[model samples]
Target: MSQPQPDPEAPVLRAEGLYAAYDGTQVLCDVNLSVGVGAMLGIIGPNGSGKSTLLRCFAGTLKPTAGRVLLFDTDVATIPVRQRARLVAVVPQHTTTSFAFTVWDTVAMGRHAHLGLMQALTERDIRAVSSALEQTDCIHLADRLITELSGGELQRVIIARALAQEPQVLLLDEPTSHLDINHQLDIAALLGALNADRRLTVLWVTHDLNLASEFCERIVLLSNGHVAADGDPLEVITQRQLAAVYNTELTVMTNPLSGRPQVVITASKNEARR
Candidate 1:
């Protein structure tokens, strides 16, 4: 694969004064953010904070009522859908397959943006698919039916599909929401390692503050469609911030291994009295 041509000085993706609404109900309000090349950024917020809307705008799948999204300085809306698909890939929250396609077959679908209609795939396409499978550690499941795979397996296959696109920027919406604890950690570790090796920019949307603290270098906390805090996890995931945004009680502590901030929900007994 050729080296990515990303501007180190400029953000790979930027949102300027983003605003969106449905039937006059505003969702995102004047949200402005930037994602640096080769950096992993996590977007965290309570429900209805417009996390998914922001991603959809970036993906060029949802047009905003206001604001503009730029990809490497060019407006996302100006780029053709097929061309944009090559530059960015989104791993949505929900994934389902009915045809029972083999893992390889499904992953190869990501290369459609690069091929002409009905055109035969070249050696390049096959190599890309193979590399993606190996990258996501799904090579063992290459020939397995997607329908028969477990949730964790299916998630990796979806990631492999995105990898096959060879995008410079990857946007994931709640990638770990449906997985068990072990799989969640596995996915987080995989993303960390992949980001280190490929230098692909990642924008991960998640509700788990601890996971974001462990994996992402920087995080943006959103509340009521605006940026509440944007900085290192230690700074953003504080007790005050969580209480304010989530409107709940919690405890924040330092992680011994990473030295980043970790959160714990305090438990109290109804019959116990201080």
Candidate 2:
């Protein structure tokens, strides 16, 4: 079966008047955003700012209380689950499995959406899985158990699974969180290459201001369930904007190499107590 092509004229992903809640408490409100093809967008905010909530709505894992999410100009909620998986892939912050699955088996599960009932992996499927592993630099670990891999290696394998799905829009919720500096850079570089080379529409929720500023083409800052700011990194990640939202003293400096904003936390008056 052939995959559905996205409408060229419409934004790859869009949220209009999106509102979501957990139980009775609202998390996101009146959120409106549009992501064009191949754009790398970072969703940044303090804890409980609805960044993950919004991403969940876009990924169609959560439905909004009001308004809607659109993928390829079609309402995301209306898309079939299997079809949706083919278009939008999400890499979550954490993944755990009690069963021991090989890296290859885990990644190949991404092809489940494309395969017919009881259908075996065809040559095309094998190629896609191999390509995903190679792209994520985890082909050598294909035979290894997922539980045996390190944090960085496992993160790469998870990404390889998403790539195997051949999604047009990739949504990551803090893909680099908890990773060391070197691994963080590796993930960032890999994401950059995928966005540039494959033109994948990438949107990720991250708390690392510097990482978002350095890598994302645009940043959307959310505060108290509302969009506080949205624009280029320099525009959204300003000292004033971040200080107000984060409720802290900080400085935003221009990185000499990337010409992007780098966040620096300054000592607060309370620091004297320490």
Best by TM-score: 2
Please report, in order, the local distance difference test score of every candidate based on alpha carbons: 0.89, 0.92
Q: For residues 1-274, what per-residue lDDT tens digits would candidate 2 score against the true structure? A: 0213334467999999999999989999999998889888899999999999999999999999999999988999999999999999999988886679999999999998999999999999999999999999999999999989899999999999999999999999999998999999999989989998998999989989999988888899999999999988889989899989988778889899978889887578338548
Q: Write the per-residue lDDT of candidate 1 for residues 136-208, one digit (tens) a residue.
A: 8999999999999999999999999999998999999999998999999988887887788998888899988
Clashing pairs for predicted structure model 1, backbone only: none
Error of 2 at 184 (Å): 0.5
Which residue segments of model 2 deviate by more than 4 Å? 1-9, 268-274
- Badly placed stretches (over 4 Å) of model 1 are 1-8, 269-274
Judging by lDDT against the true structure, name the best candidate. 2
Per-candidate Cα RMSD to the true structure, in Å, reads 3.8, 4.4
